[model samples]
Target chain A: MVIRPIVSGFPPNMHKVPVFADHLMLAQRFEHPFSQELGLTGFGLVTCLEGEAQFMINDQRLLLNTSSFAVINRGSRLMINVDETPARPVLLFFRSILADVVAAEIFHRQSGHDKELSYAELKDYRLTEYVHYTHASVKEVLEQAIQLSQSCASFQALKTDALLRSLLQSLGQENYQAIAVSARLPVVKQSTRVDLYKRLSHTKSWMDEHLTEDISLEDYADMALMNPAHFLRNFKTAFGITPHQYMMERRLELAKKLLQNTRQPVQEISEQIGFDVLSSFSYQFKKQEGLSPSQFRKQVTTD
Target chain B: MEESQWSKFKLRVNLNASVEEAYRCWATPAGLEEWFLRDASFKDAAGNAKDKNTLLQEGDTYQWLWYGYPDSVMEKGTVLKANGKDEFVFTFSLGCPVTISIYKEAGETIVQLVESDLPTDQGTMLQHFVGDSKGWIFYLANLKSILEGGLDLRNKKEELVDVITA
Candidate 1:
């Protein structure tokens, strides 16, 4: 294993958390404490900020080095033996209720829009089914929140809470997407055939930038330098759906991201993402998302 | 041509952490909540769900929760080989019709989360592919922050707008 320099220690008073809280200083030459213990319902998220160590959770064992983050969820039984005698593990433990509260509030906001009976006719998916983690931009915001938490600044705490909400909503969107797909519910509209083929010739970054615009099949065909009918047939031949379905799916995706990541009013969000008519936006969102905008916002607000 | 197939999205991440740490983060509960989400349970690779703390082994069926969708664990293929500390390949899925690949690079872990094998009939799947990738970008950012003594970034609505707009 490589020897990386240790950077810093845990946030002060982080150990004062209600759950199990402890800090250990560890280095390569130091010996570790070994034990087979079943922990309480609250588990710590342990990170080897620096140095090296080995930990065993149940039958699974792993070596923790610099920049490593591990969750010690509540109700877990594990054995630990540090290879590097003085290796330090910065641990933060909170009750399972914390996670539950986070999940419930976010889920409700993301999923609450489906109370209407007509909602039942819509598919069951949203936006999260396809992702597991977020990007650096989000992480940076989170880091800012933690830094803010340190000062007890009202603005900072507000900032932190806001960041947390965004992150959870992002997760909810992913979860919704997964459910929609597995239930055989229709997601990603079928009208985007031409755009799909055209995109095959483009890059992801480019498509992401242009997702919320007037991307008609003919326009996409022109962009690809192909005749409209030929583009249609070849696109169908390659992708299987029509150009329009493809566009709607892309639109739906943008809408989902906006719904999960932003608190913009439903009407503004609808227009920002290219839905010209509020009724059409609601109708299409219902068809693809299975929830109304207000319900989605309300559910996410709990976080 | 099947018109009802879902799309696939793939994301590659190179983390500053070790492979084992990354693996455990994905496999264990403590590690999952960092980059993944607050909800990390087990399920079969083929959509058959498994209970929490279920021993994860090659061929052990398991599924993972990704928002509202449950991940289907594909066949636990071989490690493709592990370099002891740095690099390893493991099997994870993107629910019903997609496959995912994870790899590690340098001090950073390169996770290639892929959701593939959707219908080719239209851009439906590919549209999903792009959108999901965008989502992954956000998740990966959150993961990096949490692991690096940063914040969880799970629920920052205003900041999210700032990031999106900026």
Candidate 2:
């Protein structure tokens, strides 16, 4: 274990947050893959902030990219594999008492009341190992923890506990959101529903960002690590729209924006929005907007 | 007299960006508008206004407004230390100084803020220390998000009142 200096340079209050909050944080840049059995006694947060890594839990392999975070419950058999790519993954181990406090806060905030909640009822698959797209706040703190662990000058512990506390709270909220999204999945079992939704949502966000590029269904399925058929079926089931239809809607939105905002030619705009042929772009645009691209541009300009 | 109320706090965040870029985010008015404010203007000691993209200098006074605020709602303060690199200091309120330091630690750029000399009265403690710290938390997150290629989280509409990003 390599211990770095972080505490000496920081003020007393600045250094005590994660330590006093009771989270043991570890952040390192892996030069090579280290495959080791992760003996987690408490809840663990594994984040691949940069590059990619893979984890094996319950005999299932889960890949974590920059867009995803993995959570492991206590006593879970976990193995992490870092690829040859340089990856900086931060690991945080925290006690159950803190997790309970965070879980309680989630319920309190959700109900909009300061009501007492049962721990057993609250404790569920959030404790199990699964990778999902992170909540923004959780991702923010993970960035902090990565630096805190890296900068511990001469700590009693790399305690970013205050930061970790907020992180656990965010993590609980993420689970709640996952549960909400799971309700949309057509799968029978609750856990399966949530898992399928996570995988599909993860792919959908990435796909949305790359909508202007020409990407095949095979590539999209490969990104989700599912066969194209299963990916297509579950994607529609979870999101209520087929990938093609969703892409078309999003592309039309982009097309309209470009047409209204820029003087770029319609043919150029069609190619910019990923249409291979101008005729199909015009057809889709006219169907969606009730006017051709040039007509839509003229109407906007006049109005 | 013993200090009975909390006057100030320190916030530290690690951004996945360069020290130079993080410094630019705080030291330049254009960069400030990119993440933190609807408008930010700085004037030199002689009351000469600086260019929008110019780096602030020590003793330069600044006016800042937020995204959801009208131009009438603004903060007027003075820059106390501007190193032109990774260190900046400005008066957040008349008696309060907020110093920002940017550096690299643990393979990430760390931006640290120390807000000191706050008004120690109960109302100010609850409002300035409590309320203002909440504002910093969101802006810091916004700064990180913008620099890290995530969505710009600021609520830009003037009518979007009471949002954390605003």
User: How would you encode candidate 1's per-residue C-alpha lDDT over A38-112 as one tens digit per residue?
Assistant: 233234334443465556643446465553434443454444455554655433333233344445654555554
Please list the residue runs of candidate 1 whose C-alpha ends up more than 4 Å from where it truly belongs after superposition: A1-208, A277-279, A287-291, A299-303, B1-166
Model number 1 iRMSD: 16.2
lDDT accuracy of residue B80 in candidate 1: 28
Best by lDDT: 2
lDDT of 2 by residue, A74-110 (tens): 5555667787578876666665666777667666666
lDDT of 1 by residue, B29-95 (tens): 4466556643555445465554554434433342233331112211122222234343333433212
TM-score of each: 0.28, 0.47
> Alpha carbon lDDT of residue A122, candidate 1?
23
